[model samples]
Target: MKKVFIILLFVAVSAFAANPDDLIGEKFIDVYGKDEKGKIVKLSDVAGKGKPVVVVYWAIGDVDTYKVLPEINKIGKKYKDKIILIAPLLSVSDDKEVKEAKKLLHFDFPVWLAGSDSIKAYSIEKVDVPYILFIDKDGTIRNIMVTARDLKKIEENIKNLIK
Candidate 1:
């Protein structure tokens, strides 16, 4: 039993140390979204210099998730031209409910509809509703915020990257 416990702890620690920064500088998956003008936009085009993007893959009914929109926008404002908000509004649960949630965000940022493959490529499996990913200008996902408590730390990390 003691040996088993020791192995379990080692596994947990290893998993925790699985390099949170692993996704940086990777080629982006071809994620797609419709522009406000009803045109499809792909993630490839968003990759550019002088900009680090925040990609939020959020579902509709997640009430707490929606609250972060404004705060994310604040970060966007801080970096100004250096920040891109690519929040893909998905109907992962309530298809009809996302529109209102989208409206509530009042975001001037580009909102897209992510396909299942894109979601999976970014590891969007958890039921946390509003999981956020941060990608630098080179299209590498620098970090994934596992909880809302991680937001401030995520912002600070982005600020450092932007500079």
Candidate 2:
């Protein structure tokens, strides 16, 4: 019984010490496009008042996103008030491309048009359509999810930070 209690206490202490939610309180930001209708929406101001801000860097023309975006949309809606979900279309080829992609996505989340410089800063070299980054209310970068499965980890991280 003594040995078992010691082991249990050790486990609990380790669990409490290692918090992945430490990703919160870090600072990072990506420049997004504005106009409120295109691939990117530029942030005129920084951070938020109460809720965490989630900005996803995605290119609409990719088919992967077509299947995955709805999942993202679902999560976005679930935490809408708690999170500011913004998906910026990183590939801004032309007006026609932007228009077509928007028609297909029909996403409720705000789609911003981002320039190459902004995209490069994020180191988004791949065509991965569903990259999500969470910036906490105080302007700290909490977490980043580059795929749909990563959403679960991001969600869990958010719950910790929110409370």
Candidate 3:
């Protein structure tokens, strides 16, 4: 029994240690969501267009997630033509909620209503709010920021991928 317990502990630790770096260089999985006008949108449609993409996962009521919107907005504005920014609101289905969230957040980037498929695809089911994924122009995930609010570092990642 002790040996079995020790093996299980090792497995759990190994899984935990497999961090976001493991996902780097892997092709980003495509996700589908709805636009502000209830039109269906796919991640592939907007990304991989000869420009880097910044995907930010957020929710309406999550304060930490929405709190970073202003910073993200500034980044979006600064890199307006250089990068494509997508804000996917996880678990948010209603268009009314999306509109309200937009009004409250005041972000200029495109917002989408991300469903379970998107949440699961990104492996953020158990992660905290304000998760970010930086994908290069080739659609490969270059970096990931989980629950991190470092705007400068995020901007740096974007800058590195821009060219």
What is the alpha-carbon lDDT for the whole of candidate 3?
0.83
Over 1-163, each residue of candidate 1 has an lDDT whose tens digit, in order, gives 9999999999998786534246555655667766555577777777554477777776655666667776777777777667777777665433234456556775556666666765656656546557676777777667677545456885886786586
Instruction: Tell me the lDDT of candidate 2.
Output: 0.65
Q: Model 3 misses residue 17 by how many Å? A: 10
TM-scores for every predicted model: 0.71, 0.69, 0.86
Worst 10 residues of 3 by lDDT: 120-129
The number of the candidate with the highest lDDT is: 3
Task: Estimate the TM-score for candidate 1.
Answer: 0.71
Candidate 3: regions farther than 4 A off: 1-19
lDDT of 3 by residue, 1-163 (tens): 9999999999998787545678888988899998888899998997777788999988778878777887889988998888999988886468777777877888878888887877667677544568888999989999889885888898898898887
Candidate 3 global TM-score: 0.86
In model 1, the runs with Cα more than 4 Å from the true position are 1-25, 92-99
Local distance difference test, candidate 1: 0.66
TM-score rank, highest first? Answer: 3, 1, 2
Give the range of the ten consecutive residues with the poorest summed lDDT in model 2. Answer: 17-26
lDDT of each: 0.66, 0.65, 0.83
Q: What's the CA RMSD for each of the models?
A: 5.1, 10.8, 2.6
